[model samples]
Target: MSSPIRLYMSMSLDGYIAGPDDRPGQQLGRAGGRLFNWLDGRKSGGPSGQVYREAPATGTVISGWRTFKLAGRRQGDHHDGVPILVLTHYGDEGGDGDVPPGHARFVTDVEDCARQARAAAGDRPVMVQGAGAVRAVLRAGQIDEMEIHLIPVLLADGRRLFDHLGPDHIELDLVRRLEVRDVTHLRYRVRRPGEAA
Candidate 1:
């Protein structure tokens, strides 16, 4: 069997992944970079810094069109050789031939994207980034694990991670929690609709 799909992302205390007015140059918006301060060794000690620096590379990355655009669409350097599958609408013009060879591909259907990602991942987990891709995979019941890095700052008005997940109730079982300075890393196992939390 292939490895499970994992949704891994960093968010603010208020559950926002990016601040308002996010754009090309300012991807995180005003002061939103604070959410990733720990990764740059600005807010943590040696141990935490090492943890961030020495983290294992993901096998595959799946992101939304907005994220792929915001990231500048570089080929090999973007995800350290890991293939990135971008999820976008079928008729959307932005999905055409933008990605470099051997780096990423455009995928329209959520389930097909997941299947391809799994196949590409082999024995490693497929990491899903961006709110749109994450929501799509989650709604499809394709995600098996969720690892959220919760930062200390809270952006009152921004794009929330779970803002528009419809009215469905998704349950998660807490698997692990670790405090790395000002950030809290939470790992959860996503449960099916009828499964107990």
Candidate 2:
């Protein structure tokens, strides 16, 4: 069986993933750093630490070009020893200095990217990060589940994760919910069409 594709993202209570002016230096954007405060770098013990400790089990990582770029190639290595696919619309149109060869593969098609990642991942789950990647995979109807780390702070203006998804309503089955210090984690299984809710 193919690996399940799961979208994992840290979002503010108001629904913003990154604050305004999210660039290379400002990875999460203005006050967006607060969204990730609950992450204890996989160290220590607790619900938050459990989340990070479990992340490395993911076989493949999918990220948007912007997210990959902002990581400066270093932070992106957090997945440590896993295949990382960077989704971009431009398709290798230069500006690859930050991306080390063999570290990541750039793909233009979301569906194809997800397929390749799933195949490379085998039975292990594939983790999807970045707003653009999440949006693309979601629009393509490729995401099997979503694990959102909802932060309490509200960034009124910034990049929203659910923007431009159209008017269609996608159903989701809540699988898990956990409240850790500074954040609330939610896991939902994306309900497919005709599937009994």
Candidate 3:
């Protein structure tokens, strides 16, 4: 096993990951896409811009179906070194456009997702992209790290930093913190089941 997995997400200061409308491909914003303006990606940068200015070299990217669809993906897109993985339950297959030319895999089982993510990750890190999906990974104790970009806005209600999970606790050690372009980056170790205190 290659050291579990990690979650990297952009969250509002109030902890809502996405606004309440919550439809595939429409979870964030209109033409401007202000939700992800902090992250150095297409919404924030032009086609030939710096998407990796603050991002680290991770090998795998995992996200929920909603996050995957809403966050427009370009085939062969690479940030630092991470490819993308979209999670789904076997029976919940909705229709989609042609598969992009990147390494996007649809895995039904969480364990299978973990295994595949680890394989894709190799020795590098995994950037867990959204809230509900990261919740699943954290609940299964499959995550190793979490990178959250703390934005300043606060939405009253929306998709949250965590979704419906059974009784659980997410206590992590603060690995690093930095404020860039007014956004705070928080890194944490997803404390394993029987790991050190």
Give the Cα lDDT of each candidate. 0.80, 0.84, 0.66
* Worst 10-residue lDDT window, candidate 3: 46-55
| Best TM-score among the predictions, by candidate number | 2
| Per-model tally of clashing residue pairs | 0, 0, 3
**For candidate 2, what is the TM-score?**
0.91
Alpha carbon lDDT at 113, candidate 1: 91
Write one digit per residue (lDDT tens) for candidate 2, span 29-119.
8998888888764476777888877778899999888787788754446466688888887776414644445557778899899999999
Compared with the true structure, what per-residue lDDT tens digits does model 1 show for residues 1-197? 67789888889999998888889899998777888876866345654554464335568888888887788765434457878888888433446544444677888899999999999888888889889989988988999999888898879977888877888988899997878677887889999888865
Model 3, C-alpha of 6: deviation from truth (Å) = 1.9
Between which residue pairs do clashes occur in model 3?
5-144, 8-128, 25-70
- Estimated TM-score per prediction? 0.88, 0.91, 0.76
Model 2 alpha-carbon drift over 4 Å, by segment: 74-78, 92-100
- 104-132: candidate 3 lDDT, tens digit per residue: 66666777778888888788767677676
Q: Residue 79, candidate 2: how far off, in angstroms?
A: 2.0
Question: What is candidate 1's TM-score against the reference?
Answer: 0.88
